[model samples]
Target: MRMMTCRLCGSDDLTGVVDLGATPPCERILTADQLDEPEVTYPLHLRVCTSCWLAQIPPLITPEETFTDYAYFSSYSASWVEHARAFVAGLDLRPDSFVVEVASNDGYLLRHVVERGVRCLGVEPSVNVGQAARERGVPTVTAFLTPESAQAVVAEHGKADYVVANNVYAHIPDVIGFTEGLRTLVADDGLVSVEVQHLLTLMQLNQYDTIYHEHFQYYTVASAQRALASGGLTLVDVELLTTHGGSIRLWAAPSGAPSQRVSDVLAMEKAAGLHDISGYIDFTERVAKVRRDLLSFLITAAEEGSTVVGYGAPGKGNTLLNHCGIRPDLLPYTVDRNPYKHGKFTPGARIPIFEPERIAADKPDYVLVLPWNLRDELIDQLSYIRDWGGRLVFPIPTLEVV
Candidate 1:
């Protein structure tokens, strides 16, 4: 294969981190009418820059194609909503503070900001979720973050005292441009907070399922510093979060002294060999083990004549299912809390989608959870499945039957 350019740095020296072959756009669930039509798939390979150590995939799909009419709504998960609420409550903001959140899906977090009587706005690219945010009293602007779009928001509402870009830093292919947009929207002295899945956790814990088309890149502290500096921001501090398997909540500003957490995390990354390409050596093997383990369990259940179903329709699940070649024969069908996916099928896997209630109704012997990151939340919600001697299967980190 030809060498690919690193989007974070202009490096042509990228080596494979792990390749899941190819998959359909994770979010592109198929309606019944479209099932017969040819579905498009792209390279789901994750590569790390030898120069900068930024893990990235090729920008084969654009943000517009995926985000303009998004299906994933933030409000669907109670744990995530509570996480957002607590995060908003923790910020030291007075009544006069203005806040902005990029990729603010359905205003799940901003609504809490609004409840605090602080002025807030959401920059969402998805029309459906943006409208949902507006309906909930979170003033939302439906547009992707470009420098010009950021300037327009700044011109109208004045600069934000705080800029929040949670779980979105990894979604953009144009790394510098998106960071510049964040910089433009923030005040000269304002702090910008970003939450992204930690690259270290992903590699060490075998969380390769997160490698999908929408997520264009991943970052180590060393690489993140370079990306932030390109857009005139500095990494001030870093907080390790348990959200999304593991994540880093980056606290940054126009300038500031590096915090102890930032230094500690950087040192940890270096010690783990993530400072260079050495840390990525065994990732593909680990990923293959996860695939083999999950497929073994599913095939065993199929031969034993035990029924199995899936728990969630998350994008990560789509990547896992498609890569493992799971189908309705093995999975039968999957369920999700989001009504938008009720009658649809997973993009490449073609497993039928239903409501969460379907698991209880069908009384399947086992339910394979898709969004294993929310294992605790799902366990409580699906506890009733225990009534029929049912079990939940988690495929990542390791295959476990709970």
Candidate 2:
């Protein structure tokens, strides 16, 4: 196999960050009948470009294969919905302002825009989720946002005043083209807000579970600035957010003066040794510790005759479960709020998924939380488990029980 160039910078100088072996697509929940057949897996090695500092993986899986009828619905989490609502409250928009959200899953964000009477459209690629958005009265077009598709959106709804691509920037393999698509979607003076998991947090905190096939690239503010400039967009400001463990929200436009926060985050990345790829060297060790710690905990618990189940079947959870080589025997079953996943199984772990009510009925001894990023919210929701001497466990960063 030939060495592949960096997905964002076109640099041939790609170096290893961590090789997560091979994992099945995290969102490809399997039916009982299909599990008996052959299952597919893809390489999940993440690397950094020496030239531009963008961390990425091989584009082994295409967006269409993973997102056509996607399993992730954003509104299932009450906190995430409130996060969207709060974000909408801050945006400077009027009733006449047109808004567009790329990869808008289930219209979780844009429904707030509709509530404000702001003209809005969702360019969602997932057919099932797009229908859900439409059913909720949020106008949606079910297609990927390529340059041409962006033009189609403009032809119908005019250029948007605000373009929001929350949690979707890292999903595309064609980073440059997708950035250009964002530029094409917004007017020259309009703004584009992007929220992607921060590479700095991914390293310092050991968030290796976010390194699935769907997330093709990870960005520091420096690399993100370069990525924005690739499509004639300029980063004006950035906000450090707690979403997805830790994320950076970039505010960009065709032209603008950069803000102090941009320089501050770049400086933070520099101080953290991420500016020149030195920080990536020890990451493999950190990720290994997480896997070992969780396995040790689970094995000890199982030996003690404790019932261990999982909470929330998020994509990041799939990466952690597969990397740790966890099987249904150890984890037994996991519960998710989305009914779509009720009878399905996780991609590689093959742990059965059930509705959220299963935990209350069974009163398991421990519930290993897969989506630890939503720590506070999940802790509050699952606090009732304490009534029956049940405890919540988190796997990533560190293994902790509360």
Off by over 4 Å in 1: none
- At residue 67, candidate 1 shows an lDDT of 99
Model 1: how far is 354 from its true place, Å? 0.3
lDDT of 1 at 320: 95
User: On residues 1-402, what C-alpha lDDT tens digit does candidate 1 reach at each position?
Assistant: 766898877889989878898899999999999999999889888888898888899999999999999999999999999999999989989989999999999999999999999999999999999999999999999999999999999999999999999999999999999999999999988999999999999989998899899999998877888899889999999999999999999988998888998999999999999987678899888999999999999999999999999999999999999999999989999999999999999999999999888887789999999999999999999999999999999999999999
Question: Against the unseen true structure, what C-alpha lDDT does each candidate score?
Answer: 0.93, 0.93
Q: Which lDDT tens digits does candidate 2 get at residues 234-285?
A: 9999999999999999999999989999999999999998888678899999
The Cα RMSD in angstroms, rounded to one decimal, for candidate 2 relative to the true structure is 0.8
lDDT of 1 at 80: 97
- Candidate 1 colliding pairs: none
